[model samples]
Target: MTALRRLVATALLITAMAMGGTAVAWAHAVRVSADPAPDATLATAPTRITATFNERLQGDFAAMTVVGPDGNLWSDGTPQVQGATVSVGVRPLGPAGSYTVNYRVTSADGHVVSGSWAFTMTVAGSGSPGPSATASTPSADRALPVWPFIVGAVAVIALGVIWSRLRRT
Candidate 1:
């Protein structure tokens, strides 16, 4: 019984590890394009923040925010969704410096997604109107949770141990 359990436990662990790795790999949304592009200096600030993803997006854009260097919200309204393209209009930009465009959107497949970008404006126009910084802000955004792998791991490990113990006899 002991020997059988050990073999089963090992197999289970191997399977769990493989599945976890794959889950992390598959949960990302491939960004087709961004208006300013990451870390690009635009000839001029864009009037809108646009993101094109591999999948079509839904109307429920719960996490999009266009924050300027000064800590104010720049996105004029909710993001307008058209097919796979997502875009939000911006207020006029003030200074020529770095502006961070942070966004989170839901994919057609129901995945929660988030991302960000930075653009520099070299000249500040009078009343140009752009987003303001948050009371505080991070230079970039982070990824979301992976619940599938988390739940699958516990079950796989438990089953593997039980199977090994049963086979040992």
Candidate 2:
């Protein structure tokens, strides 16, 4: 009976620890809201696109691009970051189709997050294409390597196994 109790307690401990680690991993910055919003259909083109995250962002590292339906870039100039919000100016939109907004930002915790969203304009504009939609690959310094976390999880499981064996002895 005592052995069964020990086993149950150990299982609970492992489960709790795993859940805690997952929560911490997901505590990084996440998009809370966006201007024009995801999948929104608008009658007029917005002059700017904005993304709001759950945490403050690093201004210098925050970047965004607006892509038109013909695979041309409509975003102009560098993106501006204000606290948890990042925005970039958009050219007068062209074509009445899907436009994609791609953004990358560094959270206060120093983790980089990147994502894309699309919105449709009901009417097209006569604006000229700016550039092509090309996202810069995340720099090595900004990349979050997973090897360390894998090593830590393995070490934890190994320690748990050793503890169980020692307890049995």
Model 1 misplacement above 4 A: 1-28, 128-169
Cα lDDT of all candidates, in order?
A: 0.72, 0.86
RMSD of 1: 6.2
TM-score of each: 0.61, 0.67
**What does each candidate score in C-alpha RMSD?**
6.2, 5.2
* RMSD over all Cα atoms, model 2: 5.2
lDDT of each residue in 21-134, candidate 2, tens digit only: 776566679998999999999999898899999988887767788888888889988899999999999888889999989888888767788888999999988889886665
For residues 119-165, what per-residue lDDT tens digits would candidate 1 score against the true structure? 78777744444434554233234444578888899999999999999
